[model samples]
Target: MTRSEVRTVLLDAVRELRPEFAGLRLTGNEHLGAELGLDSVARVELLVVLEEEFGIEDEVDPRIFMTPATVNALVDQIVVAEGVCR
Candidate 1:
């Protein structure tokens, strides 16, 4: 598990959640809500799936769903939550 692997997982989850993300190139700067056009419900759904995917038992920060959230920010959060930096 590395940063790139975590990123890939996140992107995959996003693609599953929103098919539009499937063909896009992510530079880690795309905002979750603003840039990605994710509403609150979609964000919550994404959170649920990501937690399941990464086995993140700890609570996720509520602020990560805010407008400024980037793809890299989520990758960092998941890596920290799971401590899967092996």
Candidate 2:
């Protein structure tokens, strides 16, 4: 899938985990944990959701989920890795 597609899927997953951020704007520079106030539990929840949605067993580091930009960047990397694996 393209980066845009990955972003859309990731955003949907995030919204599902945090309905409060459903309408919030998620830009490349936004911080997922700090800006959205997602604690460790919430971050794990998001990872689980993303795993299910993407259907890939990713080695998602906790630090990468610290921010929206980081998450986006990580997802991009994961998509490439998964594509390579496929």
Candidate 3:
């Protein structure tokens, strides 16, 4: 899927997982934890949702979760993992 499509899916998942983010205008550059207030547990949950949404099979690298401070970065990681480009 295209990056924009991926971003839309990701944002939908985020809204489903955290209703408080529903009306927020996310630029995909906002930090998931620090700026978005997602704790470790929430981060893991988000990762799980992404993996399921993207059909990722292998175990996701822990570093992937740690490094991405923004939703765009996280989407980049998913793109790489799914072997697709924008």
Q: State which candidate has the highest TM-score.
A: 3
Tens digit per residue, CA lDDT, model 3, 1-86: 57887677767767777788898877888778777777777667776776687676455664566667777898798678755545
Decoy 1 TM-score against native: 0.64
- Give the per-residue lDDT of model 1 (tens digit) for 1-86: 57897677767767777788788887877887777767778777766766676686445565564433877887777567646556
The worst-scoring run of ten residues by lDDT in candidate 2 lies at 77-86
Consecutive 10-residue window with the lowest summed lDDT within model 1: 59-68
Clashes of each: 0, 1, 0
lDDT of each: 0.69, 0.62, 0.72
Model 3 TM-score is 0.71
Measure candidate 3: CA RMSD.
Answer: 2.5
Which prediction has more favorable lDDT, 2 or 3? 3
Q: Pick the candidate with the highest lDDT.
A: 3
How well does each candidate superpose onto the true structure, as a TM-score?
0.64, 0.60, 0.71
Model 2: per-residue Cα lDDT over 1-86, one tens digit each: 46676677667766777788788877634566666566767766766776666575565554555444455675666555445223
| Order of the predicted models by TM-score, top scorer first | 3, 1, 2
Question: What lDDT is obtained when candidate 2 is compared to the true structure?
Answer: 0.62
* lDDT order of candidates, top first: 3, 1, 2
